[model samples]
Target: IRVTVTAIPIPMACSPAFEGKSIRKEEMYAEFGGGRSPAFELLRVRPEAEVEDGKVTVIGPEIETIPEGSAAPLGIVIEVAGKTMKKEYEPVLERRIHNFVNYGEGSWHVAQRDLIWVRLSKEAVKNGVRVEHIGKLLASKFRIDFPDLLDAVQVTLITDPEQVLTAKKEAEAIYDERDARIKGMKDDDADTFYSCTLCQTFAPDHVCVITPERPGLCGAISWLDGKIAYEISPAGANQPVQKGGLISAENGEFEGVNRFVRKASHGAIERCQLYNFMEYPMTACGCFEVIALVLPEVNGIMVVNREYKGETPSGMSFSTLAGTIGGGVQTPGFAGISKSYILSDRFLQAEGGIDRLVWMPSVLKEELASRLKERLKAQGKGDLFEKIADERNAETIEALTEFLAGVDHPALTMDSIL
Candidate 1:
């Protein structure tokens, strides 16, 4: 059978505004995977003989047939084959799906991996957009973006509950394996690290040196992601950073990192301590997943994520704290970090590690529950996890201090964070 390509009309005249625009709940025609149902997007490298180029298949009802305002289970599986396609680049390519999909007019995508949440505006659906169009859009963009790395691309968009369930299981396994591989990997294991200048668009001098133990502050790019990005585009935002002589292992200072930061920041920052917050902390680019700040009064640190709206133990909200340290300035006693990095073995090793953590949003704590427990246990502080205060436990520094004292929090006895 032969297939025909048709251009689907996008709303808002297909302007760039649609690229990163968010579709609020009321504006959404349909939504998927914001804890509503099983949803995932996966990409795999397949042998040339196994891939059917340009194939776009929708396993269930098309978008046009679905009722407006309905939520459905969705799964996207993309397979590509090329002479140069490597398995290591699968995650990198998979991540592009979010950007490509969001570029479609009236389409909004947020997050990534299994926790992806997407919405199609009523305007797009009314303009004859179908689920298969998503596959087509993705295939077209992938081929254009990675002409040298991808020879054939195929997309399978599934909406059937059984199909989504089966696909989600497989996707979860892949995600787990990727996470495990990254977890087992260490910064010391590599002779080279990577620098991500993507955030430079906002903070021109900010450079993110991504390592295995510490991913990008945005919680989006991993060490592997950075490596793949550099391979794909040598002059792109992600570039290789040779790990030169170690400067101070205790503070995670490297000759190469310091030199690179100085050059990248145009001498704005002369030094940076990767594993410490109080001494020459890395600059924030405003996209960090979490921010940890010293609470001098309590001699501890309070952690807050981008999602937290209430005041933290630092007497500041997330937005307030973000503005203070962001924009490529190295603020002592303040550091931006990824949620996953909070569980890494190298988490703030210089400042007493996780033991320095005194407060975090309850939601953030709950999200990292499993890994937090394991990390704490490895540090022989398994019982300390329960002692950490959240917004519900204490919204003010005074209340937070009292709660920490009551729980016999370890941070109380640690070195003064100030």
Candidate 2:
């Protein structure tokens, strides 16, 4: 069924750009909630020229600009199929914040993706939306009409005075809930997982899948958000394909999983078999921060780094290929790894091994380091623990080259080691 939703801008609340310079009609890198970043265009604009006693009627595309260096702010009325409709707001902010981070000033992005539904059926109701809370979220409001006439709808709005605090608080609350749930999981429990998988386009070989019990290492999407996404589109941006059973080990290969991986990646990840330290095994995302290669002369392996900030072995920047990896199908058994996942050795090592993770966040590195120690203690390999936790230096463009230049362990560097 075709559904239409109207986006009404709340007065003096949502901001779209920095200073008075509004984003023109151009497609740019944007994200919605934790979904993969999508290209967003400036469909239209409505400007509010007058405000009396907090009541404003913003005409099409012209809100007064905030002072210099302030966020581009405004309210809007999004029309869909002529009727007032209910819609989701989280994705809008997610996309906007992502644009700001990658294109705008430093890392200040809005956080909340949860938007309460508003019904907009009649004209009066639709007009009331301009003053309602949902509109306030986007800095505009509306009521829905013919609520039963549609299945779903989402509208995006550009606001003035970006509502970062409200969104951040909501995002944090969701994260806290996720942390609580995962704390109750056993060491080796399998459950449905969620991730951005989109990020792989940029961080290939790095698979980041998050379960209800585990938060993503990047701390982006939460379990609650994942559940909402699944609800929104079971087959589109929201659903996850589950992994079942094990792969057979023949010639160090798992036929079932290997077949699945090849089919999913269209044969891009052909070498992925049953082992972790094997060459060209299925990378979570085509984009990898580092590629672990075995150097026969050194009797060890070295890592070719991607996503590093400095000079790489090939003198390429992380941004050069960050788009190749995270946004598509990953290993067969694993769901897409776009946004979040636990920082565990089992998950990390499944690709190549720890030597590749020198570039992850400090928090994740430390968490993994501590967890590895515990696991090592269990297996009595504690003496061999080298505490490879260098937040500032691990994944630098230089370090990745160094990893590939030196080798300490063959098994650790092999493309697949069952």
Candidate 3:
């Protein structure tokens, strides 16, 4: 749905025009998340009796109380009640939080789920903006955008350190639950893949190709979510792409996908590989939760998430590299991805799959540790998990090489990444 600027009781203007706007460090008043402190955002479908329309509550510190230019903890919990809203619809709606929050001209938001990092400009606080206003904006927009599906929307913004930490765990558990819904389904299981253009406003020529194993780059829409979204609104941005004929089974190129991506990108992109990360892989929009790139110096690859602010062994920060590869362009040797996509059986298949991975953030490694172990064990590569390096192990390519050699990581002996 198109974002419309409406009369909301917030000091800053809200519109799609600000969705891509950046608030540099000098312009900030307060910042949250981005690994600064615990932070999360969650949306849930609640019973009709549990939600109160237009209710917005700030559980802790208000704008006036937060110290200037300091990092803070935050948790946004939204509860919605509607006859048509189902548990399956939560993720798609939850993702709208990123877009709507970015709508505020003085506020900048990046990433999603618990990895969200937000900034508020001093200019906005001077105009009387407060934390509660954010909740008001969300409650107002959710109703305005999904009038047919939502009868009531209530938002609770938690800034209290204790509550933020508590709510974050609740949100993470739900996120894990949502991610498991499409497990065991493979790309070969379906003849028809799905495409979503919901991010066209951010990247005009982008088309999100969603298969059973790979989700949208935003990490929000799954293959089942795509089918459900299409069923809900046939005329909506999500549509099905028939996998007409196989172009390259190993590289995950399909004749019908090529045709659809060509038309969807308005001829900007002709071919998209569902699994290849080193050559003409899927195009990237702005909101990918993670990014994977080839580390030619080491003949391996490194994965970086949005929450990681430090430089990787490849000599670039996540944000810096994202700027180079994003905007719906197909960048060979690099690909944007969702965190869950790392566990997929098809991840980087063209580059020798998981064996090519060498470095990631320590936090990300811990987050994926449990499930990653299971996947590695299934592949009889459980020993490979300990071979991977994080920032804690090495922050530079030279250091990474030494670390890899010491650990005897498999990527050191893999085929040439190029």
Candidate 4:
């Protein structure tokens, strides 16, 4: 199909896409192509380009120059290989979900037109493209071209399309199948599991263990995924460590994960672990603020925030040096992070008891939130007890770091703290 598209920059356009007559960020979609090889071309436009009746009256920003920043707007022009058609269209919600499944998370944020784009044509609409089919097409046609996006791009064929009625149902089925085997496992209550240790580079001395019942503070990965990742690599993504036997006198004691923390931190952090969020404790989640550390020549301790783009206080990039401090192991790279695992025992701990918990993101946490809340309240601290909550992001990570830095409450560490 022969098509031309563009992205338009708009100051008052309000809506990000055609679907959002009001909100600029919303997107609208349509289908094209099913016939022989179709010719296609892409063009970019500015946000102010008039799209009133569907005919391109004015041009917007240049396709290549379309700024990646949030303030800029873009327009995509699609011309069929044979016909001229333009109309405001609403995309099914499933389309976005499929995007996530095939692309993992935040596919659009990092995606460029070269990765995927619309190929409008008369036959495309006639075929009535389904998200599953699109995902497969991406996987078969474009997945390899973007190797960095394969896992994130959850491309899968819908063997039985009829069963998919809603996005929620689709998500449920996918997760159910993935989590079926990990329904029951246990971690020592004192172990304090978490997946937010990845944030150590960004928010030092803060660890957020993701449990089967609770997601990470960043709301990124679910415990089930974490568990699977753990199974894939035991010593790599995260390592299980003892917490109870720690010899704590004030804040400078604790064994197991604590010793691991000191080594991981290169002796930068003095004493602390998941359970004791007090001074120089477990590192923050990957999505956190203020990375704390004990740098050579630096007096006392040094803290780095999300914006401290300069050399890290640890003499390592926050991204690379983070794994070394969080889960009792030192990881040199960030690519293996998504592959980290979660174990049943991490959440179903029975010894010492758990005080605080942390994790990434997952629906399983939502389903089991109430039960975890009850468990926390039963251990006293009912006044401090709220509910088993989940959070994920770069900003809230600072809060998590702060919490672990001072809170001495008995914590339950997870199997995959990193």
Best by TM-score: 3
Each model's lDDT comes to: 0.81, 0.34, 0.89, 0.31
The candidate, 2 or 3, that scores higher on lDDT is 3
- Candidate with better TM-score, 1 vs 4: 1
Q: How should the candidates be ordered by TM-score, best one leading?
A: 3, 1, 2, 4
Off by over 4 Å in 2: 1-176, 183-236, 240-245, 248-317, 321-342, 350-386, 389-418
User: What's model 1's overall lDDT?
Assistant: 0.81
Best by lDDT: 3
Estimate TM-scores for all models: 0.78, 0.43, 0.95, 0.33
Candidate 4: list runs displaced more than 4 Å. 1-165, 168-216, 219-230, 242-244, 248-253, 286-418
The predicted structure with the larger TM-score, 3 or 4, is 3
The TM-score obtained by model 2 is 0.43
Model 2, residue 311: distance off in Å is 6.1
lDDT of 3 at 317: 96
Model 3, range 21-87, lDDT digits (tens) per residue? 7888899999988788788889999999999999999998998899998889999899999999999
lDDT of 1 at 145: 79
- Clash count list over all predictions: 0, 75, 0, 97
Residue-level error in angstroms, candidate 3, position 9: 3.0
lDDT of 4 by residue, 1-418 (tens): 2222222121111111321111112231322111111111122111222222223321332222322221222222222111111111101111122232222111122111111222222232234432233333333322233233222222222212122123224444443443444344433333544343433432444444454543443333345445434453344334443444657533324466556566555676555433223234433433332233332221112233322233432455544544444434322212111111222222212212233233222333444445544544566545323322223221243444444344432332322222
Q: On lDDT, who's better, 1 or 3?
A: 3
